[model samples]
Target: MSFILTLANLLSIAAAASGWLKLSDGPWSAREGLMAVEDASGIVMVGGRANLGLAAQHDVWRTPNGSSWERLPDAPFAGRAYHAMLSHGACIFVMGGQTVALLGDPFFNDVWRSCDGGETWDSLGHAPWQPRAGLAVATHNGRMVVAGGCFGSSIGAGRKFLNDVWATRDGASWELLTANASWSARSGPRLVDFNGRLLLLAGEVGFTADTQLGDIWESGDGATWTLLTATPAFSARSGHGVVNAGGSLLLIAGWHDAKCLHDQWLSEDGVVWRMVSNATWACTADACGRFDFWPVATSSGLLLTLGGSNAYSTFGKLWAETWALPLLGGGRPLRGGSVAMH
Candidate 1:
């Protein structure tokens, strides 16, 4: 009887603690390619393509508790998608994304910062780096490191991929650490600060090429990068969500092998990875899938995923819905499918 009671208690705790709770659909319509970053205020999502390629958005949305949301004023910068946004100290910086909806040209190198949780913005002007979209940026060792992206349209007209590395202490001034990185020129890879180093992983060359890179690389300074692994256990992918959660690195859903993936991977030293859960917060069937989503780690040990698209076709649908999961130590998911509030 004692064993039964203990088992019952464990089951009850798992029921409440595990699974994903889908929150509000957010202030905007369905959209993809939005930039989201977590700061002291909460989760702030900015700029995305509305309804696939219909129009680009400059609107800003924030949620303090992951359920209730409020729309802030439109960002002072022009509407864009595939931009890089991250928090450094108390300032939130936004930079380097293409304008127009999804298929247009004219990338942006302008930098903007918000001191008040994205309520208002001030222009920091364009940086010395080339204007490009789908770039990766992360704060490392009290400095911001920027690297790799694509220039030109999504459909291959004048498209060019890049592998340069840049860094900035102040948003106004930027320095090119290396004009060419050790990694191949690619776009949309996740650049994350992991284990006191900057880790870059898994992005495609371009939409036209459809070559997804699976290798992993790391760097202490912005200038020199070392390839950690040429092939990881997880398939090569891009548009995946990556976050350093609870002292472990989590790699979430992405596109691979001409289809959207729904697996989750965790790594401690940024080399070997293990899939903790493959059946949580994503579509199990091929009829529905998601990518280009943003996953942010909260202070309370909850992993929140916001805003991604379900399909890549012209009739594809974008999501403004938010999903939350309580993670165990080392960023492991408790149960594969405990509860889904979608």
Candidate 2:
């Protein structure tokens, strides 16, 4: 009889803990592309350019408090835009961005790493992702997963929108996970980890008479992808951001047909999608929102996003946005919120 009572108590404890995780918010918020990196310490964001043209730059930001922000080290890389960065243990690995040469034909595959947080960066090596723009990457297990981006002879016309998956641990080498026609050939798609699995969600493809897709997919491994959701969440979007907020995965705003979208969604499994409360917030445009937002987990247990660029404004806006949903037991579905801009 005593053993039965003990078993019952243990089950109760497990159920309560899971419920706490479901309602809690992990670290979250928007930041410039260069400044963002996820590690055990928190999220760190590095250098970013204010305009479209690439001219070597170095600026940085980091967050431990969801409500406030702090400045970190300026990156050492020559100024470039549309680059990718990820966190591994104590180091943040950054790769693939646009660097202007003499004729204004700008693109590169150089890789770098930052050890002392985001304060400084060191050149790692050449990347194997090829010269591309609006490409997306996310780190999982011991490897960095990369897939589907735009590259080519021309900036607009004849651009190669890809559907290939690549993974690397050392920047000097790359492993092609899958190159099948299975994935929707896209650029600017968001890559993230959901429910212990990897997911590639939403992006754009084609030019001239353009095209875009907001379709969602998930994978156990980086290779074969499974079609989870066929419909686009709000509209066909690209250049938008997604991150792990609280315990649930959150999809933030991005560009759709040259217009900006602020609609949001939440996923526990990442396959089934649900629009969450206040998912669509602001309607604006600029360079900052083009990449992933830096969501850092804090000691007080809040998720935060700092300042970033908007597509419409020349003088970019900085933010202290918080998805401060109250801690409720179990997963109480909070769906749909007003879409507005501050």
Candidate 3:
């Protein structure tokens, strides 16, 4: 039987003084599929789908701390969404996403790396994996590992969901660890490096509302995976944010049951989860409560999320509000601010 999460259960562990604190909306316009990672230098965000998913922005943005954000130069590669980005060693790597504009093929398998923050990038050539979007990625065992995504255009035929796994120490070449993972093929799943293992979390099979999953899986090596739970304490979801925050695993907002979710979950191991009460951001606010966004766990004991979209089909609504949740200490109440929508 599944473990049901109730209001009393959520309130029992929720700290009254702790919740999501809204920071100033950064420089970037409202967009979704934008990827961000926290490294030694700071937090760097990359390309996203803007203008109602018709325009893809190649521009990069960075913030040393969440308070201030600066727009970096446009990337060398074409702008795309549903791509994956992560920090490994001294390199920040980006790979595999689809373009919004329907011109030629929309999928991309090319890889690029930035050594000097997001100021500049060098092409690492194409990857071994097929062109895909919404793929899950994480840094594991001093290498970057990528798994599962959707391949095909927004309105094209022959669309395919994948469950393959690949890893690389350098972006130039990739090793296929597994052609098929134990989990079902899905897109927009959350992959994180936690407790010396790679944990894969809930994701969706397609655009259908009922296709979302809440299963959790883990792997020490990219080749083999073990299922931790088929049904978690949280509801089935997709496009959620999963990160390692101060040695603990955190699952943030996502889409579930045809509605945008604003709740947060905490776990020491992938098998058990706890709802972090009062830690959720405001979903009722204008252009708030997003899925398919990136969340980074900083060295400062704070979990940060910047931009994401609400719906799955069109990805029409996007958000730019920056929210920070304190994982270790007390958090302030929700604050109000104007969110600029383009």
Candidate 4:
């Protein structure tokens, strides 16, 4: 009996040391991934393209352990993609993205809030900023700040990119922090609140090849910005996910030069980045190689990534699988170490 107990303990340790675990499949069929957030109750997924027709969806779902999912009612607005979903205090907010249109996709400046943990939503009316999609947003110092995205239809000509910044304490009203910031006009940059400040990572400028950038910027008040590095340690890529794991920040998978990247990086500060993982590449869609998918940092210090897709039918496939990695303890990098997967 003692030997059997010892064997069980060893197995448990080995499972934990495996680095990643594939949890149960999400309820919905794979499509373009949505923005996800974890609150006191559980993790909530909101708004993304559907797998059937590639149309935007307004469905909301929640999960406690990533093994099971509970689908909430549809949101009060039309289906959209590239939107932002964040949890602040007792409420979860969904803001700005483009809606599926037959003629040309129209951008949205609307903001919706759910006070009872995504059970029901109320439109806060349109935000003060212009309608846009692929903007980076995060709650900083008890206020939400939005920065940089592309406006206009992505399919044809006349597309406009922006680098403007705005902030709001409440969802209804907003204040323009800056008309234009130092960073170039871009879309799909990864934004996060780190150490009470806002950090913006790499993003793509125009809808074409050779437009991705690896710049990193920091802002204290969202008005004045500081360029941490014009060129970062990692390659230039858009559609990546960033999370503040403990005091350190982690950058997840994104697309770089037609390749779907599976590499991950970590930084104690925003400037110096170190590659930590080189997982296998899966998707290769030009518009949605895991784009717009948000990674949730759980209460137990484990990071969870839900459904995502590449959006290209041939190369990109929708995913319902859940991936997890433990980020507590000394999971951070020890400065100046060689780039190696953990």
Highest-lDDT candidate:
1
Q: Pick the TM-score winner.
A: 1
Off by over 4 Å in 2: 1-35, 40-42, 51-56, 66-73, 100-105, 153-156, 206-210, 278-301, 306-336, 339-342
Query: TM-score: which is higher, 2 or 3?
Result: 3
RMSD of each: 5.0, 9.1, 8.6, 4.1
Off by over 4 Å in 4: 1-18, 280-291, 311-315, 330-342
The digit string of per-residue lDDT tens for model 2 on 1-342 reads 245544224334433332111221222223334346556555566554444423434566565533334666556776655677777667888777665466754666788887777777788677666677667788777788888777765554767777888888766588888875377787778888766778787877753224767788888788988887778556666656676645667666665665545556666666655565333322233332332333333333333343344554323443434333222222322223343211
- Residue 274 shift from truth in candidate 2, angstroms: 2.4
lDDT of 1 by residue, 162-252 (tens): 9999998889888889998999999999999988999999898866325889899999897899999999999898889898987788888
Give per-residue CA lDDT, model 3, range 1-342, as digits (tens): 758954323333332333455565757888788898877778999988887777888988888867678888889899898899988898799999988654587889999999888889998889989899989998899899999999874344467899999999999878999999999998888888888989999988867678899999989998899999998999998878887765667677788877777776667787887665413564453245668777876776566787788875564778787776555532211221122111
- TM, every model: 0.90, 0.73, 0.88, 0.88
* Backbone clash total, candidate 4: 0
| Residue-wise C-alpha lDDT for candidate 4, range 1-342, written one tens digit per residue | 245544224324423454555666767656563778888768888877665435788888888777678999989898887888889878999999877676754788899999877889998999978889888999999898899888875556667888999999888879999999988888888788999889999888765548788899999999999999998888898878788878888888776776666667888898888777655122223433354455787776667777665543323566777766656552442221123444
Task: Score candidate 1 by lDDT.
Answer: 0.80
Q: What C-alpha lDDT does candidate 3 achieve relative to the native structure?
A: 0.78
